[model samples]
Target: MKKGVFLLCLALYAFSVTLTIFVQAAGIADEKLRLLSSFGSLISFFAVLAMLFLIFRLKDNKESKVKSCGQKQRKNPDEKNPSKEKYLEFAARNGLSRRESEIGYLVLGGLSNIQLAETLFISLATVKKHLTHIYEKTETSGRKEFAEKVKAF
Candidate 1:
């Protein structure tokens, strides 16, 4: 809709410029020619403004869609996913330390050891150690069992 309006404005500007040129060639009075040229200039200015408005409008529309999609994807797929407080509470009940809980959260999100190490600024060995502790504290072994325990929280 905005693009259509802008294109219509551009066509109007072209028409006005053509008319002004013809009026000038026909030997109209200087005052009349000046008025006609100025009118065309005004139309051209408005056409440019309309085009700019449409560009910005389209950009904002695209930005809004991307923002909404990002927010939607950020939602957890499982309806039974615990809130932050609930997750921390469950981790505490299972005797996991704060760092272990943080690691467990990322682990449950399916991050690999190298990815977890990079994200947490820890060594790969440290990531493996944290996972071992988490498994021990949660009484669950390996990725599948660990994830099942976290989800069952």
Candidate 2:
């Protein structure tokens, strides 16, 4: 719908420009020619504004979708999955903090540092900090070792 509106505005602007040019070349009266030129300029200005508005709207929508999807993926790990429940229990057993446990669960699920950061709405440094804490608490060196240990549950 937005694209269609943008296209229609562009067409109207083009038609207005053509009309202004035709009026100019046809030797119309000065008053009428000025009026047509002003009308054309107004049409062009509005068309540009509409196009910009649509462009920004589209960009905002895409960004919103990404944030919402990230939020959805960040849902509580213990909600429905048996494996996640076990993982959370394991995290608790190992004395991991809540934030550390969350990061650990994502790591176990094979999320990269960047994915973890985006999904949890934290900085990459924060995610790394959580991972470090998780590793220390679980007696693991890194993601691979942690995954191996968690799977052993």
Candidate 3:
């Protein structure tokens, strides 16, 4: 949508420039008016280009952040300290119900309580209850700490 608007603006600018040139050739537009029109056109074009460059840079930064987040998720670990899978396995090994495991995974995935409730077809109250039990069992403060602890697993 933004790109479309930009293109439309560029096209309108081109049309305006063409019209200005035609008017000047026909002796209708004065020299001062023509010079002002050219200056305005240059400023508008540079401004648009700068804006587009900034947008591209922002998009690239967002992509890099997403890639780094994925890399963190896929990091390999030695057999010594507990890994994320191990922590999850421990949760399962401790006889946590499958629903609780699902909740744990969602929490680890950075979903908020409301997001988890919507995704799991559960109520917000139920999500809170499950999260409380999860915190107690995992011995973590909240979701952010829970995710950090899981990262060590």
**Which candidate number has the best TM-score?**
2
**What would the per-residue lDDT of candidate 1 be over residues 36-99, giving only the tens digit for each residue?**
7879878877877887888899888767654443332223465344567877888999999989
Which number leads on lDDT? 2
lDDT of 3 at 5: 62
Over the stretch 21-122, how does candidate 3's per-residue lDDT look in tens digits? 676677765777777667767766775675577578767865765454333232233313345578668687645677887778756555667666656657
Q: Estimate candidate 2's alpha-carbon lDDT, on a 0 to 1 scale.
A: 0.78
**Lowest lDDT 10-residue stretch of candidate 3:** 71-80
The residue pairs in collision within model 1 are none
lDDT of 3: 0.67
Error of 2 at 86 (Å): 0.9
Clashes of 2: 0
Question: What TM value does model 2 have?
Answer: 0.51
| 37: Cα error in model 2, Å | 25
TM-scores for the candidates: 0.47, 0.51, 0.42
For candidate 3, the per-residue lDDT at 114 reads 64
